[model samples]
Target: MPVTDITTDPQSLTMTLTAEFPAPVERVWKAFTDPSQLERFWGPPGWPATFGDIDLTVGARVQYRMTSPRGERSSGSWEFLSIDEPRSFEVIDSFVTDDGEPLDGFPAMRMTFEFHETPEGARLVNTTYFDNADALEQVVAMGAIEGSRMAMAQLDAVLQDLREYAEGKGTRVELLDDTHVRITRLVNGPRELVWRAHHEPDLIRQWMLGPDGWEMTECVATTTVGESYRNSWAPVGDAEGEPFGFEGEVLLVDAPRRAVTTERMQGMPTETLNDLNLYEEDGATLVTVLIEYPDKETRDMILATGMADGMESSFQRLEREVLTAARP
Candidate 1:
């Protein structure tokens, strides 16, 4: 697929995605279980993922190395948390730094993979748990969005392969003014599901994030027009963490794949984000999120905060998930 080279501030963050697959439960399950099959699709794409010694049992240890185009090797290990043959599994995924030192940052990602049978094929659901908001924020700030979008772009990148796929459409930052920055993306799910993704408390826990150790204490959004709601997002170990993010509000909710605006009480200003989900030629639905910030500060803040790179990266990640979930 055509890759999107996402660049970011490495501090402010972006990228959040979710997808559904049309393939069977058993097939999708194997893609995760069998190292060989998983390796075929995993990694940064166009890059190499060398699956070394892999042991799939629970509490088992495995070492895998991924080499970038520059031939730099990054190694990570996986510890199985829970596993059900051809069903579901969970694991704590982390990277091992050179000199054998354990790096305690971004690589410390946890994931829960699930496979469910459907009339046509199977449903694959991957819920990635964060170590804390800091890592989540860092990755978001770094290149999560661009990375995922690049991965998802692979779908159109390759046409002959019959495999899984996912995507989180590009965001629209309608330069609202000199003080605000508008941002939005299209999600490939029903309006209810998409709405729930942003509004539901339990669902928000899985996708929203903050600084490495920070966790969202609460996200209460009122899905109504003119009825405002507040969301409390902060560092885990320290609720009142630095760069306090005690903010967030919903201005309008256009049910079934559409939201009008958003506001950050103290951190950032307000924006009108129009999120839309539509269909493509091949029967796949495409999502489009359009946002308009209130003024120049927000716009400048977003740009200065590495908005372009971060948004691009988030798009890439969403692309990856979309391709994976869209596969039949």
Candidate 2:
């Protein structure tokens, strides 16, 4: 087990757990921040977790549900209170209803996660402060201690395999559910430059094109919430494809980190919610886009169109034609 010690202090109404891992602090941090890796071990043995789009910035909320083998589900939410990347973060942790309302009688707790470098590798110090002794006792009676131990134990495999998981994998797509899909790509560039590439028209036109013989005919990009942006592309020379375009209104924007938008093909009524997140490690950024469709039909229809393959092509061009040139 990764956990070396667990202690509770009724006087302070706090519980603390110390765990060590044989990995760098940054790698351990990513295991918690990335939803894909987090879901693998956030729940105990028979209970598996499913997380929503996780925004690690302060004031953002994250929701997740852990379902038991018997199909019972426990939902929770975390409101980020503060963040210091690769070092520590604090959150208001609460047992919540499916719609995210706090569950009655289950008081919320203040939780802090601290990461430190050790001679062997890295160490994680997790402390949770309750409002009172009763609150802390209630959580312990609910199997929090045993569950947490099992959950943290599972992190070892994740930290050990992250490199193998991402290395050499181009753009990849995963069906998250009936109506949601997640796409991820790792590019050799910084997060700021990658975010700019998506917003600045001049930079976008250089690499947003999916394949050769295509050119961006029009590009209108925006970062302000509620503002609409449009992008259209057409074939050049002897290229064999009709003109196509996409338009969307920005729902949220946190520069260099995350963005959310509503996207639709021009003249189409159906739309998808796109949540874009960027995380940088060792000078390279991992781009993750979670898309929510109106229904399974819409999700399946879009995937059938070779969308992932086209995205891979564009990402390759993005590295070769844009990011490389921007790097010093």
Candidate 3:
């Protein structure tokens, strides 16, 4: 992660900022060009920008508004002057009224954005020029530096999410049927490494805990058909809450590719059918887990418990513990 650096030069009547993202140049470029992505981080932390109109073509106008915490609104417009894909672009930006009219006597800026490739990742440079030095000083007095820094920090978070998704460390839940949920992701390792991580109790204990403040106390797994497995977990400290555990019987097993099991939690009302399917693509492993509940109501209730978030935390750990360890 890189902190955004902002500098203003009185001699040149310009303010320049630079930030780095841990992603490919092309992906980083898309974050600026894509309206959805831009909307996620275009404003300061609390004031989120909403793009009402976006036209990236030369001479086209773009309009957006940012709402404050107190419900106050600020509008702005940008007219694109030039664009070179994945490299650079220039726009004329200014404050505007609700009716899309530029504010009288307010300073307008010519902004250029440049993307550069680096060994670590992508570097973005933003240069904003004012017609005169007085305008530059006026905007700085309005807290422009602090605001841009906060907005760039938000962009850092957005980049992290995009990278996690691309590496298959993100969880995706799909409703395959009325009673079944299919969660699939590309795990960043070979089939054998991922299989071992799941089967080995020590390795499973490393990443199976859903989120912070919880840990698996005991784990027992067997891959042979007809064998039974058990797991126990509880909060990390004090352990005052009810313990969570599950018992399951393996119904089908195929080395590193597939497995079917039936599991019941100690205090849960229903038993679930679990199927694990694995596929190899390039050097990575694709994992698909299907869990079937007794009825639609049960499935919906479980999904509403924010189960996907816990799975996301677990898989993110798996990427570090299993995939990164297996890297050649």
By lDDT, the best candidate is 2
lDDT of 3 by residue, 249-292 (tens): 88766678667788888667588887776655456666767787
As for candidate 2, its clashing pairs are: none
Total backbone collisions, model 3: 0
lDDT of 2 by residue, 1-328 (tens): 7999988999989999999998999999999888878887798754557789989889999999886523467999989999999999999999999999999989899999999999999999999999988999999999899889978976865786434546479888877568878798888888899999989999999899987789999999999888999999999999989999999898867677667889999999999988787767667777878788999999999999888887888999989989999878
| lDDT measured at residue 13 in model 3 versus the true structure, 0 to 100 | 95
How do the residues 1-328 of candidate 1 rate in per-residue lDDT, one tens digit apiece?
2232333322333222433444556666765566655454455442335465567678986667665422357777778988898888888777786544567654477767766776856555555556555777766765556555544433231221221233433544544234433354544444444455556666655555532455566666656665665556565665554434434344434355345445455545454333332223233433444334455565576568655554455444444543344446
Sorted on TM-score, best first, the list reads: 2, 3, 1
**Alpha carbon lDDT at 170, candidate 2:** 89
Residue-level error in angstroms, candidate 3, position 292: 42
Q: After superposition, how far is residue 64 of candidate 1 from its true place, in Å?
A: 1.7
Worst 10 residues of 2 by lDDT: 159-168
Better of 1 and 3 by lDDT: 3
Q: Rank the candidates by lDDT, best first.
A: 2, 3, 1
